[model samples]
Target chain A: MIEVRLFATLRQGREKSIMLDSKDFSTPGDILKHLDIIPGEVSILLVNGFHKTLDEKLEDGDVVALFPPVGGG
Target chain B: MERRYERNIPALSDQECRLLRSKRVAVIGCGGIGGYLIELLARIGVGYIRTVDGDVFEESNFNRQLLSEQPLMGRPKAKAAEARVQRINPRIEVEPVSAYLDKNTAAEIVSGCDLVLDGLDNIAARRILAAACSEAGVPYIHGAISGWVAQVGISMPGDGLIDILYPQGVSFRDRSVLSFAPSLCASVQAALAVKMLIGRPVETGTIYYFDLLNQEFETIRLDLGKKE
Candidate 1:
């Protein structure tokens, strides 16, 4: 299973963590679509603790963290 | 060594105090987080401070900006920071740029500075400042707030933490911050700056994320190739 974690504004009205079968999602963009999150709304998308593009392939047991933009002084 | 910083002793040694006095820092943006950061650094006796902000205090800034007052409204934010620094510690040297840092001016603003602090509100300005600091080989402490959450981190030279955190050409949703969010975040940034200046061990290339409302704090280590 792939573990998805959300932070900051991304957690609003949504579970902080969601689990999905590894075979069900192919890329971060696929997971975002399944979660009903727009690609443009995400600012940081990390897979297994490193920066990865939306189209990067995912593997089982990978930990994905998503954070929305929080730009303010 | 003076009576003003007497309370900082034990927490900070006498040698560290002297080191702080000899170091110079540049704070970009003079609203919200910038206002409190300037005041804290002044009280801590950072000898030289260069404040760069082209914006002025408006009525709306009173909710969170410490330097924003009825009398100071319509005045340049950097000038207000300088005055506040002087009022807190007269011996500290303060330079008010009174101008926003752009591509052409970012490098010059960070030049000759031991450290740079981010108090910018927009992604575009942060990208410019972070690139300038990277080019100048200076360490930058970044802080940002939105409502009850904030993130603070130190970007050493080429980490490109800003770029990693904020993707290029991305549109960020406009979020309003509460009055206490900036103050809380600025204090954390100031503490980190003090630790770095005093030769204390501060973990770099990692972002400290805070959720004040839920009392949850987490540190996310960036894979910047410098982590031990």
Candidate 2:
């Protein structure tokens, strides 16, 4: 299982915490795709506490976090 | 000029005050966040400040912009910020550039700065400023607001956090910032800048998230030091 955390509006109006079957997803991008997160909706991606690309492969027990651009004045 | 900082004693030691006094900061906007940031730096005895803003105050800004007083609606924000800084601390050196910052002008505007602060409302402008700072090898302090939510970060040379913070074509609309957002963000930005200047290491490459509604704060660390 993998832990997924969402920040700000990236929560998708749902619970902040998510767990996914690790075997089904090979990368954070795969988890996002499984969840149907819109492309470009996530501005920052962290897996196990550091920025990683969506294409970076994820292993079991990997913790993924997503953040959207909160840019404003 | 030094006497004004007398009261800041133990909070900022004489040496620290002297360090701040010798440093110069460039503020890239003079709307809500920039206004408060300018005032904070002035009061804290930062000797020199360079402010830039191409916009004139609109009545709409009255809701959140600290410099948008009813009487100064038509005035350029840069000029207004200069005037306000003068009134607040006459001894401080303030250069107000009443123009917009683009790739062409960023070099000229950001010259002779110890650090640059971003008060831009949109992602595109911030990207431009970030690239300029990176090219100059100066640290860039970034703060942005969306309603009661705000994000602050520090990006020194080679961080490339701006590209991560603002992905391609992320167009942030204006008029979403509440009065509290910029004020809060400015305060955070100023504090971090002071920390950076005084030789205290800032958590560079980290983004601080402030949620005013729930009053919760979290940090997103960008640098891992090793691949996961």
Candidate 3:
């Protein structure tokens, strides 16, 4: 199972975290697509608590977090 | 200890208080986060501050910007920050650079500063400032806000912290910011800045995210080596 976490505006109308079968998804981009989030909408994507690109391979039990661009002063 | 900063101790030691008075910091952007940073630093007795911003306050900023008073709508934000600092602590010296920071000017703006604070609202400017600070071997404290959420972090020289969080070409529309977001975030940055200025061992490569709406706060360590 892979755990997905959302932060900031990314959490609006979405579950903060959801568990998905790791075998069902291959990359973070797949999770975003399954979650119906546009790739451009995400500014930061982290896998297992480190910065990762969208195409990085997903592993079982890996925790993925997505954040929208919250750049403001 | 001076009576002005009496309340600042024993939270801050006498030596730390004196140390803060000798440090010079550059605060980029003078609107939301920058205004509060300037105010807090001035009241905390930071001796020298250089405020950089080319924008002027407008009616739109009144909702979230501390220095955006109705009377000063068209006034330059950097100048407002300088004025506010002088009013807060007459002894503090403030230099207002009423210009936006760009690649050509970023290095010069960060040079000769002990530390730099990010009050910028865009990823492009933040990246430029962070790179300039890194090149100058200065520690940078970043603070950004959107609505009730804020992220604060410290990036030591060569950390590439900003890039890790905000990759290049990631652009998004400006989100609405409530009045309290920048205030809370700036306060957090101020505390971190004071801690760093007094030679305390401040952590680097970590981002603190605050979700004020849910009252949730979490710190995430950025392992740059794990970047993929």
lDDT of 1 by residue, A1-73 (tens): 9999988777878898999999999899999999898876787678888767799899999999987777888
**DockQ by candidate, in order:** 0.56, 0.59, 0.69
Error of 1 at B44 (Å): 1.2
Q: Please, what's the RMSD in Å of model 1?
A: 2.1
DockQ value for model 2: 0.59
Runs off by more than 4 Å, candidate 3: none
Q: Give lDDT: candidate 1, residue B80.
A: 89
Error of 3 at A33 (Å): 1.7
| Model 1 alpha-carbon miss at residue B129, Å | 0.5
Candidate 2 per-residue lDDT over residues A1-73, each given as its tens digit: 9999877666646668899998899988788887788647787788888788878888899999887678777
Looking only at chain A, give the TM-score of model 3 against the true structure: 0.94
On TM-score, the stronger of 2 and 3 is: 3
Error of 2 at B118 (Å): 0.7
- Which of the numbered candidates is closest to the native, going by highest DockQ? 3
- The better-scoring model by lDDT among 2 and 3 is 3
- Weakest 10 consecutive residues of candidate 2 chain B by summed lDDT: B167-176
Task: Write down the lDDT that model 3 would get.
Answer: 0.88
